[model samples]
Target: MTATSDGTPKVAIILGTRPEIIKCAPLIKACDRRGVDCLLIHTGQHYSEDLDQVFFDQLELPTPDYNLEVGSRSHGEQTGRMLEGIENLLEAHTPDIVLVQGDTNSVLAGALAGAKSNIDVGHVEAGLRSFDREMPEETNRVVTDHVSDYLFAPTEETKRYLERESVPGEIVVTGNTIVDSLYEYRDLAAEKSDVLNELNVAEDDFYLLTAHRAENVDTRDSFDRLLEGVSRFAAQTDREVVYPIHPRAQSRLDEFGLAVPEEIRTIEPLDFLDFLRLESAAALVFTDSGGVQEETCILGTPCVTLRYSTERPETAYVGANCLAGLDPDDIVEAGTMMLGKCADWDVPFGDGRAAERILDVLAVGAEPDAAEVPT
Candidate 1:
């Protein structure tokens, strides 16, 4: 493992997607203060400079020391490429421990590479389970959690899930890092952006829509149903639906000859700050994202999840989120209900000091006993 001039251990932070970058930012800064040499590595899974470069600048995260340039590809192809690239980087850098966050393929690849190299792997935002075998992300989470030496769960529920599964690691309940990052960046965005003024969005004038799941986008029927539902809903209501079109979703929209309705404003994927401003000022949020569910819950903004199930069910448990599958009618009904609902909901996620708790656990240097593998 690489050592500092005075022989301190080096910590390598691995990130690839936009979410990973944001979630890892606070921890990276924390490591910096402790005199630990931090090396940031980007797997380049989502390699858009516009979507990525601005986040690093906004979040004040250090630019990656290594970029693998793995970019967008088939699931197997991307994972294979990242695994090989990460293994090579581990050989070269030899960090004391490799840190990966969330349930991304990049995280699984990093963990597998670290385990194969006999280096310690620390997983942040770990022990989350959707219990749905159909979703690839669920598989990734399970694999990464099993391989990881440290499992940093975001809630007691997540920790309990790990305990039931007999996971061989120290599962610490550190709360959600996204909440910490969200509150920090939200304050900054409110001060810097005149987003509310520019958009002419009052506290509850419009609704935000974000849908880019593979299950929803892979089929023409599902995509059409979503568009039709939004179109019908917008026609019935006076409010506008602002959709920040994902690149993959945009391509599908064009290929399917689907027009973005006049009432639906299709904009590019927003940076963290702009997104926070939009979500905060919206009357309601409709998404298929787990992160968005938690974010909207913390903001006390009602949300309609466009998927059948969510990894973050705490939002629903707290009466803040509604699961409105891909059916257009259900989507509209859920959105309408959220719009009229009172904004007094409890934050199921803990108070936003998850990063500090996670670092505290890591600092203790408590390693789990290695378990024997069943043949």
Candidate 2:
């Protein structure tokens, strides 16, 4: 109903979390450059100014066209709220396509809302699987991929998974958009982020950590073990571990009366640029975030993934990362092993043009001559 005057398709880009913001930024920028008509919608899954608003400011992304303010709640309640709000939006300003990136409650709700409303939905970073149904993210990823009209798979490995599942979407291997954002912002991060001096840490002399997954941090035993492992690793390596704690993780630590070891320094959440600068320079990065795994691998930094299984197996296969499930001994061993290895692994993501490719596909679908996308 809200088509552009020239029949240029209007796309509604929906996101709710910090990771989604980071991944979708390149596509948003591409839309602006190509004169593609698009509107951004914030689901407000992450409402903290530190976690949400700072990303837009640091990335120079435009303010969202709509903000549902559907703050945190039980998964069912949160998804239900988002579904209701998104359905209303779709009915009111029916866009030609609804675009969502990454696996989250927001992704699932957006895909379902679009599908139910009879509107096309495009899923970015589709077909990634840890194959662990217990992980909520895995469910979100699987459900979103199936409901999407366009599946922008990041690799042949991911494409194979979709093929095996026989998803109905038109599958395109457009590589990962993270590559585009990283390539675009690395130099800017170097020039602008003074995080190193502020933290008083030297490049390649410290370890970086991020463990905020519910499976890891929601339980006391698991959270305590994770901290113990990282503490042990830091002591053995004689290097400080910088942990920019997530709000949820911080809350759990307080509730459980837990503490990080002396060698591990906990700090406030960082904007994308500062975090990118630290990730790029850190000697080793430890995390349970799939995004961090991809980032550290792309930056040629050795990574220790803090989970039993990873959706990003390419990182492990390419010698860029090792999985050390929450055991202290395992974490120390993995850290020691990775510390001895070289950081010259081949990048498996893409050529830094995924956003352009995605927009091109959408443009052709909208109208043959919608806009001329750059090669």
Candidate 3:
């Protein structure tokens, strides 16, 4: 890895999704503390200014050095555009390492472009696989991990996944950065956010809902099923299903001419802190969001994943989450079952120091050396 004038490695952190921004926040702050030369690049995968810019402002992250603004497109078009844009930026900036997180088209393109540029790529939250080749993110994570030079696995389980696949990169089991963000921002949310008051809901009285996975949202039938489930559950239980609708999901709903039932309260996307407060206080949550799976686990809140499969099996294994695809009956059943269970459980993520450990690996050129967990 090439070092800058002051000897610290130059890292270009790339992310395109709102969840990616939240996950990368701790690492960005860590770089600031170490005086490492870092550049944040937003791929503009989620183009809504409210969703994208609000996170940067809320989390106090430096504005992205570059935003491809490649907005949503077919997988081929999006990846191709990102490949071109990221390649240009990497060549011009000449960063020592390109860091990307999670399974997104942006992550895949960034890793590919960086490796092609002969710059080592560090993939945070790497080695996750749902074993379902049909899922776009499964392919993204698989491709990204294979090409990356530094594979920062969130858990030993994911490390095993990479090992089973025989990936070439050095695997360092740094706990999920989501745990760090949750711990840091949960308190901050309580201090700065009045989300609950604005929504007119008290702690533990409502079920926080989020559903924006392409599989569930893009498919007309699946999207309808999710709404039906939420509506049914809310009508039966007399509890509000607080849904902070994603822009993409809303667009799909409009296209399908589907309406969220009066029982399911819909609102705009919440900033990172506000969302954290909402998640922490919810009696249970229903969503297909991967980050939420990890966050709810750390918060000791129950979650009912609205997808067929999940990359984060650790949450299910710890009994903090239940998977109930797009089937309305199944969704209601899983939500009811989870709500009936206890909230307190062992958090399998980390001690909120993942960012520090990640920087430790980068400091030594991502060579596996020492840690509480390394797989």
Q: Against the true structure, whose lDDT is highest?
A: 2
Residues 68-116 of candidate 2 have per-residue lDDT tens digits of 9999899999999999999999888878889999999999999999999
Q: How close is candidate 3 to the true structure, as a TM-score?
A: 0.95
Worst lDDT 10-window in candidate 3: 366-375
For all candidates in order, the CA lDDT equals 0.82, 0.90, 0.88
Q: Runs in model 3 with CA error above 4 Å?
A: 364-371
Alpha-carbon RMSD, each predicted model: 4.9, 2.8, 2.3
lDDT of 1 by residue, 1-375 (tens): 334456777788899999898889878876776666787889999989667999999999888998998999988999999999999999998887888999988999999999999888888888888888899999999999998888888877888889998888778877777877887888888788776676677777888888899888878899888777776777788878889999999999888887777778888788888888888888888888898898888877889888888888778887899888889889889777777677688776666676667656566222243122111
What TM-score, computed on C-alpha atoms, does each candidate reach?
Answer: 0.93, 0.95, 0.95
User: Runs in model 1 with CA error above 4 Å?
Assistant: 1-7, 364-375
Backbone clash pairs for candidate 2 read none
Model 3 error, position 322 (Å): 0.6
Worst 10 residues of 2 by lDDT: 366-375
**Any idea how many clashes model 2 has?**
0
Model 1 local distance difference test score: 0.82
Clashes of 3: 0
